[model samples]
Target chain A: MPVTAVLHTETRVVRRLTTDFPALIAPDETAVDVTGLDINLSGGFTVLELDNSLRPASPEEALESGVDEAAAGARRKTRHRAASVALGAAAADPLSHTSLREALTKLRLAMYGE
Target chain B: MGLSVKTGSFVTETATGSKAYTGLGFQPKVLLLWSVGGVTAGTFRTGAYTSVGFGTDSTHRAALGWSSQNGQNFSNCARTQGPNVLDLVQWDVTTHIRADLVSMDSDGFTLNYTTVNATAKIVHYLAIGGSDITSCTVLDWPCGVATGNKVVTGVGFQPDAVMHLSIGEPSSGSSLQADARLSFGMMEAGGGQWSNVIYSVDNSGTSDSQRHQQTGKCIQKLTTTPSVNMAAQFVSMDSDGFTVNFTSVTGVAERVFSLCLKGGSHSLGSFSAITSGGPAQDSPSLGLAPLTYLLSSFNSSGQASPIGSTRWSLGGSDGTSEETAWANDTDALGTSASDTLSKTDKAIVICSATPAVLGEADHSALGSDVFTLTWSTVPVTAHELLYWAIGAGAAPAARIPRWLPVMRTHDPRPLDAVA
Candidate 1:
């Protein structure tokens, strides 16, 4: 499953410095889950157009890519830790619900491939 | 190690002092700032001042600034005055104030300026960060009174893009009354496509401003007669920078400041507005997804649609902030506003007296290597649009297998069996 985090946007921008992973802000308040990507929120936002290949994959993807189950689990743990911190940071802001909605929607798609 | 960018604004100190803009998260390799001085009350007029600087450290850097004085007078600091990035003065050159980027720090940069003139200058800046940038160069060239190509070289590498400013020496000495031009030119590496907007102010009697915009031209001098009516075009992207061909010229050598870039994916070209069929238009394929883009419009023959009007826009996503600056002779005014609905394709350019949308388009979708420009209202006649796009780098051509087939940890067969 994909990890989740809320992101705050100022003028629709989320600073990359606010998160550990590469973050993509949603176009609007409507949260979007671009699975394999990271999230966060802050100011001085510059939209970054990233190469899709570099995105981080879920544990299932790691295993599918031929990694051992233990290795995939380790990757999951790392992602979880990073997401937890990002989530806490974004949730602290009252204006992060839309970002959260986008993030949750992305997470749901990643989890169920919906 | 690829190029990354950040945009923000700051107000210059009322008193002469040093200040730092921190929290950028990455050290910037180059900085470009345009004065938003006219937006607030007691502020300077917009486009009156602009600056560009480069270097990772203060000790080994170069900077330049160009400003237009109200009486059709102007001045520029080109790597002189000890590394200062800005030199600003009031309508007349009285208490000349200066500022410098003294340090380029890990997280941000520092600026040291002079004097509290009561009114502070609000500056908008774009900072480019990354180690992969091959070079960031500043060039000050002269556009003399003669019609010919003025090829600018010495960048040391084929630059991907360039920004130009036109500052001519005052026809009369210290009095500083004459014609000055504030120009912005965008040129791409591929095909040498170019587009530019030149705003010239002639303070002969009253403050008279002329807007000269063109799609296929670069550095141009369009002041009233006897002042060198010059028009230039992009020649080629040379190995050691690029070249410009000034087809028409006359007058003393006018100074031009250029900030050139090397190492980054850049796409620049022009397209015409649709007046037939449908209102949908697509820019020439950039071959990559762009992070930011600038679009400006001109007439079919490379002049403003209404002849004496001006319009240009800069846009990017993040909640999508689009900034537009427009002016016309009737109003004799220039103003900018932030539009949140701006996207890669959904941006418009207008040059009406009321600044109504002569041509309106919204970014419909960003494709793999192209974006769709869906016009809300097509122009009554065809207009030309010049656009420049910057990308972090090219996208991967295809998804490679995430991993080569690896042997199972508990594989019964020998590891070398498959090999």
Candidate 2:
């Protein structure tokens, strides 16, 4: 019989549910107005103004703000270190297909924290 | 998923004037490319799988649509291999897309396409509204002539559009000749919009046409009599000058009187004495000397203030010695020579009298120098009656008998003492 480690370590999986997705687009046909948002989300997530009062934080936002303090800081440092490594790899081997993909993936992981 | 595949940038050019695109190995999706003078390149794509080529002989090009042949790989389908024609190419895709091609070399060129819609031509004039005509060679239309309002349909090099003008009744009391200056011009009916074309109808000088000459009734006959009797008298015998004292009535100040011999029938020199008396004689004389000199200074309101004193010499060299003597006496007595005497000689004597008194004398036969002495004296003052000595000599001098009340009698008095 294989012994399974039944030790329950707390692993937080924060989920933010958003049903009104179209509201992510600006109501005005022209450029978006994001002055109300405290955090800029256009880099990755499409920030939405769903209702006047309710604005739940997204998954990306939770990961950014909800991690354990020391671990969260380590993760941030690790992400910055990974981005710098990927940029060095891209510069060294720009034409190498493998290096390009690896660098792009690292960059995405750093931004989205996958 | 088995294999998701995408294909790209396959270009083909045709030979000069070759209208049909024939065999290229695999029926790869076709995109036509054209280059003009190695400078410009244009591409056109035929949606999915298709092939294009130029016919060896025919001018019309062909775009062949292909469905996959059984068991055929994408490579096996015909593909346009290299470049095509080296000259201009034109094609019509469906109905609306029309394109023209120019080929520079084996590798480059441009395709120009135009989409067109059908339209009709509209004609326009230089001056849409009308043109203003200042003068014209022919004065066919005159101003103020009214024509029935109509749309300004068209205009010509010369003013066209037949116009019916109402010349209105010929200027009142004027003869209507064919050649008169009949005013005629186009005008919008109802609205007083005048036409830009105005002209005068003159009968080109050959015809007898009269221009409008303004005539009016002789200025209302001014039968003005001196408000007070004129101080000067008309004398026919002596030809001695006289003094005229003109006192204007309140409203009569505006009246201007010109003194000239009436018909040129008689010879009388210009005015010698023109003095203005006051409102009433007792009010004092507003003497107007050299009336001609002061005519311009008369106030526009017609107020006759004292201009200055004026005197007429009765017995100067222009008169006989007796007249001269009379004028001297008159000057001494502070009386006008014209007021007291008829014959120049006695006029001198009477005018010279101290405390000049009225005189009586026969003045009937004083020949051609017949004169009428007229004047208004001071309102309430006592005046001695005076007369003229009729004969030439100074022998029998005449005197006026009674005291004449001022402003009363129009008779002449002499300077001789009464019996």
- Residue by residue across B333-386, what tens digits does model 1's lDDT show? 322211111222235544343435555666555555555566677778766666
Q: Write the per-residue lDDT of candidate 2 for residues A60-83, one digit (tens) a residue.
A: 543453212224334544665676
Which candidate number has the best lDDT? Answer: 1
Error of 1 at B166 (Å): 1.5
**Alpha-carbon RMSD, each predicted model:** 28.3, 56.2
State which candidate has the highest TM-score.
1
For the record, the alpha-carbon RMSD of candidate 2 to the native fold, in angstroms, is 56.2
C-alpha TM-score for every candidate? 0.56, 0.11
Docking class of 1: incorrect
